[model samples]
Target chain A: MKTLYIILAVFFLILSAIFSYLPLGTIALIPISFAFLFSYLVFKKSETPNNKFSKILLILTIVCLIFVLVKVFFIKNELEIDTKFEQQKIENNKDAKKDLEDLENDLE
Target chain B: MKKTLLILVLFFLVTSFKSDTENPVKSGESLVYSGSYNMSGLLTQIAQVNMTTEKVTTAKNNYLHFSCSLATYSKWDSFFKIRDVYESYVNPISLKPSLYKRNINEGGFIKKEKYVIKGSKVNSTVSFKNNQETQNSFTIGTNTVDVITFLYQMRTVNFANFKVGQTKSFTIVFDEKEMDISLKYMGKETINAGNLGKKECYKVSIAAKTAALKGKDKNIIWLTADEHKIPALIQFSIPVGVGNLTLKSATGI
Candidate 1:
């Protein structure tokens, strides 16, 4: 049962890492992180046969949780740049029109 | 312990799949931006045409107004013959829900012989002659030739199925003859239009085997890089040189 718990915790941790890039994935990391922490706590209390493995899985889970949080925050800048690029495009159009009109009169 | 672990694994898997559904923009929503185009070409028998157009629009509708002058430098005359400028305004109203009342106004100079025909001084009048509607077609025109051509072109676009990367191929039959045409999806690109900042646009290219104004070799148009898919740029090769038309500028108000 302890081994099963360790395996499950590792599985959730991997899933969390895969989804860390997506917005909704950040929320998902919470439950998986808790499961890893809880399993570690439970396994630590008992004299489990795979105690070393449980410790490794617990460490991995913590690393994934931290990685996910960092990724979610890092994404903000990229989204902001995309927004600004769109705004610049609109402004450029307005200026081009004005210049063209002026050029039209100059040619005449 | 096993049950708790299994539950946790299942929870994470389900949550990962859910992230794919979130999108920032919704369908049927409109976004507006400004666009500019520069084109240089020759107008058969006439002087070289270097035109620039600017445009503004929401995702669904667009207004393009352009003014251009022709510059002629002939070997025989030596002196440049620059004509009085002409301007045109085009508002491509998006018929998203359905066709609505729209207006098209065009006034320009056409040089004939040695006289520069001024559009304002000439007997040029803007009038609405026909307003007819069928099940899938609508026609409004003060000019019969222009209106008929507009209506025929409108029927070719399958608005119901138009989407990104979708290609529409058809033949336009005018005066009982078929003109093979193919409009291909050129995807999206970001272009910086001089003073205009930058624009994200879905580029579409239209090619025809033969066009009314010129033969098949010179008929190509780049449509508006927005959701409306209006023709923002048009270029055609003529017998003498080439003619290019662009959306210079627009005023929504």
Candidate 2:
């Protein structure tokens, strides 16, 4: 029983860590909560002194939770125009203008 | 007597298709929106969408250029970068599109498409990531238009005459194919219009007969009820979950 809980706690902790690193915002909280719950279960089931592994899992979950919380509250979504895209857009405009002029000549 | 009746019928047919109402969207107008994904009711903003219009003068003709672009936010750029632009050149008064272009680059997948519309026929060209290009021509309906022009033309529709639950259909050329699109009026709704604050808007639902768009009424949009008729909010449901685009700012209305 304790082994299963430990495995689950480790899996959820890794999942939450990945989610926290991404731009998923508060979604990491779901896996973080699960990690905490399973870690607690493992800690309770483990014999004394052997609870150190479970404690490590709890600490990792807390770290991911805090990181996600900070991002959700402090980070503002802003766009930085891609320079390559801008150049591509300019080139497209030139081509489109030439095409339009050709069409106008055809119509005339 | 028969000749007179035939002329009268032709006059009515021509007048019925002509709308004298002024266009609601004006050149120099721009609207910015924040695109967000909803997961279990939590909203995570992912991209910024900008819609702008400008007046362009060709060698012998003048037109209105309507452009919409979507760029992933700086933080999300590294994960799955996206920079897509859609443009339409249309008649200033009638809003009939003459040229349309789409440039899409998402996560390294690149595609370019253009359509030149002449009367009831469209000349289409497409280029993919592998540098393969194809050109084709298609006959379209008199009222058919490209997707970008269709979006702008949606504002010109006189919704006051529409009854609740009334549906208006349009044909839009997208991805080199003509598809049927429908908009159903769901009446008036007041929603949070982001930076514009609370606004009363016309609630409408969109339906398309395509695999990409699923569900009947899962995609809905709110356009401000004012003369500008700006698209204030949009809610769409995908296979995974729901997503939204909320208006962030408006200028040159």
Candidate 3:
């Protein structure tokens, strides 16, 4: 059981790191952090103290969560800017057609 | 077990929120335009006009062409003028290549004009010809003249590849006139166009830095969001009055 707990904690820590760049990283990291904490509790009966392993897992999970939060906020502005540019293009095309038609009629 | 169920619910909620905001319309799809209005000229001569526009992709060159027409009383004088204007532009595309082939029965106007812009250092010449004997010519510096057909050609090519959220910016040069313009999509909205019923349309607005014609105002075009981005309804407000053009009926695709 103790060995299994260690493996589960390691797996979750790696997953949290990988998804840290996505919007859902913080939420995903929550379960992984809980797993690492629960695993520590489960593996406390071991003869040797796992202080180094627990510290590394906690640090890695925290770093992953922060990375994901930053990414989500950074991309928000970029999405708005892209939509604005597209809107401008549609407006310009409509104006050009109207202008052309009006010019044709005026000359006639 | 309760915690696991809560997590699952939260995951679904987050994903559903994201999916709801995605645009439903695909890029480069054609939409229809329809609307109706009354047109009147100098003499209190009123005519009820209905107009419809359809965007068609030509199989020959993949160019996007707008096929549109307005129907009103046959007695209307403006109808002849409008027909003349339409023939001037539309006939050229078909007749330009076959200038040598003239049928005795095909009695139509053919006009051609050329203008040269000789500035301090820049020089360019533009030709405008129709099937009519009367031709108009204008020459100016390279900064003010606009080539009317070039704008139409740009629209043809750009709109062919245009995506829903893409903005196309280009400057059209005629002889000495230049019109710098931008087209922006304002998304889809349902408008209550009287008599034509409620329509789901892509509202597009246009702004031009320079307009050559006096009565031409900044344009707002509404295209039905179905299978044609042709202008279903168009509204332009000048200093004199407001002009609304709507698609009443259409025959050709």
**Which of the numbered candidates is closest to the native, going by highest TM-score?**
2
Going through the candidates in order, their DockQ values are 0.01, 0.60, 0.00
Candidate topping DockQ? 2
Ranked by lDDT, top first: 2, 3, 1
Q: How many residue pairs clash per model?
A: 11, 0, 46
What do the candidate models score in CA lDDT, each in turn? 0.40, 0.88, 0.41
Here, model 3's chain A TM-score works out at: 0.53
lDDT of 1 by residue, B1-253 (tens): 9999999999999966553112111222222222112123211122333332334443343444333333332311223223322333233232111111112211222221111112211112222325332222223222212222232233335333456657666443332234555665656666442223355544555565553445542445554344344344455665544555544332221
RMSD of each: 26.9, 5.7, 27.4
**Cα TM-score of candidate 2:** 0.91
**Lowest summed lDDT over 10 consecutive residues: which window, candidate 2 chain B?**
B14-23
**Estimated TM-score per prediction?**
0.28, 0.91, 0.33
lDDT of 3 by residue, A21-63 (tens): 3334235556556655755654474566766666666677667
Q: Which ranking of candidates, highest TM-score first?
A: 2, 3, 1
lDDT of 2 by residue, A36-100 (tens): 99988988887896767878888888999999999999988888857888898889888888888
